[model samples]
Target chain A: MGALSWAALSLPAKPPGLAKASLDRLGESGVAHPVTAVLLNYRGYDTLLEVGVLLLALAGAWSLGRGEQPAENPQSRPLLLSLLRVLLPMLLLAAGHLLWIGAFAPGGAFQGGALLGGALVLLILGGLARRALKRERCLRAGLALGVLVFAGIAAVTMALTGGLLQYPPGAGGALILVIETAAMVSIGLALGLLYLGGQPPEGARRSLLATPPDHA
Target chain B: MIWRSFDWFLLLAIVGLGWRSLNDRDLFRAVIQFIAFGLLAAVAWVRLRAPDVALAEAAVGSGLTGALLLSALARMRRREQQAVPPRTEASE
Candidate 1:
């Protein structure tokens, strides 16, 4: 019965003309990639909400329980450490390149941010970013920065153009870049934290008391 | 004709990997299959002309998800090892 019903249902031969409409108005966003323009300009609200949801997920994870500290001693793996030393800078450069080329290519904040998170995960695995991660305040700020900046832009643009996330004339590209940059940072931190699985260890407080004060 | 054949092969690989990932008895092997499935699916997305989705699928779908699953498995194994033996004598 189910197979017969499924076979009886005929789908449309063509999709709705949403893509045509998007392409027709693509110049307003000033980006060569229609996907990028749609994501950052035409329907930025979705991305904003997505970032917020990621932040909420991290928050919920932190609230639920603490992540177990990695059992392996990173110092034992000299080869891995050396490899990371060579790989880290390349990852950073590539991530930045991806973000920049997003204006004209298939890369963007999410792709770049994933690379950044991968870098963070490498540092964690190598025990390189322990001190930096210890700065919980700084980490929290980075996690929230994307959503805050995106929401702020929405409010500002709403006031300027009288519509939420509607960019003022000639400033759409620049505004999108700003939002993407901030979102990249936040997304990277959030993904890394999600992998970490729970609240970071508080043992860093004791270490801080024993050592001299240092900036993040 | 060759390209058409390749697409069919790709489709079969994707479906086979997905099926194996879901039904495999070994957790680790299942996760590996899942990652491979994600990678192939990303390729399929590219073949369909959605490079943006392809990039995301490769990065977040396969890479990050594979790492997360491996770590979660490790944690589960550790917990299971710690919990297997009961401590009855000390409780009184």
Candidate 2:
């Protein structure tokens, strides 16, 4: 999905077409393409590990934003805001393409998603205050839901195939694609919010609601 | 071919920019140079084959941190503006 988006946007520039090349090379044998093999090897476990790194960034960003709830005043303008719109989707596509190509080369799910997360962070900083205003609970629920879905998939795999995060070898390609696609959305959302600077309006309102009334 | 050796050049740029950014005499120049350092660092990540790290570096390094620094610069400018009081004595 990202790769397709990238291709659509990068129309004239036309960065190297790894997907076409990789697809053509599928008719051959072992580790033929350095880029794809680096990405796709071991059904993309390496990519998963790299994604954990971005997860760490999310953790780190989240930790830094404590003790204050910065309110969103819709008045903040081009203070790094407009660029967010232009850069984000392009970054997503680039990351996706890179990760997909990595299935044959050095790109992997983790690296690609991290790039997407990075773009997300840029957007947040550029002042897309969406999640920091009203989307807090829905966003958290989304993160929890992602974990549940991943766990459910793994459990079902274990029940049917006696192993978790495991898919039949012949179906590895399709399975990896499915996992990567799901993970792209799940991981990107968490990391984007983590990098966002402050609490959404609801969380702030909730905290205010939690405070006991001042004693007379 | 030159682009392939982009990693080495990128590292060199990062080191040079980092050193200048940390030690420059002018505070404003130092901050701008720090952003350059980040851009170089991103290039290095690309060379290292970690697009993930590169992207994060670009965002946090240049985007967020850079904005923070620029805000500080703005405040400093306003302070300087106020500090240079109106000509009360006489014109040179």
Candidate 3:
């Protein structure tokens, strides 16, 4: 019965509300990707708040308890290390490409950041990267950078344009790109930290696996 | 017709998996089933023509969430083992 009802429903001839109008003028919004335009321009304030929520979630997770200490000088299997050496670069490249294309295609800051987060988790699992309390300042800055940049841009644009988050004419694209790059970095770092679940111990061990033979 | 049938099958699979995951007795098995459900949900998102949602579901939903769940489960298991030894030794 539920399936039948779902099947019976038909898509509207045109999108409801302002979405159609927004879609029509999306290109002029300085983003080729309509979704990006909607997310970062038409409704940018929401996205900014969403990034804040991600940071808030991290804070909550951290408050739950300190995570178990990671092993010191942890060693990965030579094969796994070699595989990661090859894989990590490709993942980084893909993340970069996703961020770059987000302005014109289906990719965006969130997707790119998530991929980067996945890569960071892989590195952590492989013992190539360790969370360290000493690095908390840097990590916190990275996590907050997106929201800080976004709010700063909005405030500056508001002063210039007399409207919140309204980018000046002819500069919308550049500003959005700047915000997206900052957002991508913050999102990536925030997600990575969230996966770590709690404050890392001081001086956590770094990966000490020997370099693969073929690389030498 | 074939596409419609495929969608139906996909929907049923999602529902079945969700039910199984929720009702599974073992925490580890439940977590694994939940991850499987997440992957299927990604497929369903793709079928709904929302690639962005599908990507998020696949990456954050299945990948990261699954990792978090498994780690939490491991910690719980370790605590249980620690608790059991003391109690069992006392009883013996």
Candidate 4:
């Protein structure tokens, strides 16, 4: 049966159908990177839906219960703290570089966002950005910003071009950049909050504010 | 070729780590194996000429997932310890 099926299935020759079309029409997306073009222009709806799904997953995780703090964690080791001090800035720089290079290279919002998320996770583990992260209002807004911006762009483009996410003339590059920037921020915050496991307690906010920033 | 052999090794390592992680009795060890699996899978993605995927696999799949798993493992252990009664000499 396996051999029969293999024989029955005809393999595509040279470039596949969509690949040929995509290569021919690559300039229409205006993104130098083929992957970026497909992700943010050719099949942007999927990417938009993906960001929404990620936000939904974070929402589901948050709804579970209040997050419990790690007990007796030696996250404040002098060695780890020092390492974080050096690593944080470099990681943030690399994330920004990745986000910018996505237009012409094999990097994009997801990769950059993941790196940003890693940095955020490090900040959380080191307990350095406790006060910043505690800004629930800002965090919530940032968390929803990706999908909001992406969908907003889609709607705007739809109104202008008569199709969802269809870029208006020469605006594909800038619009993708805007959407990706918002997505990177949202993804990083969402991942950091996911590591937090659930919604933090109300009292913990007051306590964190009282403690000195360098206490960790 | 040397590259072909390396690819075979990579494949073996990925499969072995994946299987071991799934079946391991110890959660901590399993998570470590899972992380190793993810890293190897990232290498495989790179070999397949998908650098974008390779980046995501390494950053999100290995790094974030591993951190999350370890955090959850630590929490589970802490909760279990809290639930169990401490045995004193008198109780014994």
Top candidate by TM-score: 1
| Global Cα lDDT for candidate 1 | 0.88
- Cα RMSD for candidates in order: 4.0, 11.9, 7.0, 5.0
Tell the DockQ for candidate 4: 0.85
On the 0 to 100 scale, the lDDT of residue B3 in model 3 is 96
Q: TM-score of chain A for candidate 3?
A: 0.84
Off by over 4 Å in 2: A1-128, A145-150, A160-164, A201-216, B1-11, B24-32, B42-92
lDDT of 4 at A113: 93
TM-score of chain A of each: 0.89, 0.57, 0.84, 0.85
Q: Which stretches of candidate 4 lie over 4 Å from their true place?
A: A1-17, A71-76, A203-216, B86-92
Note the Cα lDDT for every prediction shown: 0.88, 0.60, 0.83, 0.87
How high is the TM-score of chain A in model 4?
0.85
Candidate 2: Cα lDDT at A141: 61
Highest lDDT: which candidate?
1
Docking class for model 2 is incorrect
lDDT of 3: 0.83
Writing each residue's lDDT as its tens digit, candidate 1 over A1-216 gives 688867667556675968998889888887778889889889999999999999999999999887865757888999999999999999899889989999999999999999888888888778777778788889999998999999999999999899889999789889989999999999888887777778876555655347645742
lDDT of 3 at A118: 86
Give per-residue CA lDDT, model 3, range B1-92, as digits (tens): 99999999999999999999999998899999999999999999989888878887888899888988887787778779889988988999
Ranking by DockQ: 4, 1, 3, 2
What would the TM-scores of all predictions be?
0.91, 0.55, 0.86, 0.88
Q: After superposition, how far is residue B39 of candidate 2 from its true place, in Å?
A: 2.7
Off by over 4 Å in 1: A1-9, A206-216, B86-92
Q: lDDT score of model 4?
A: 0.87
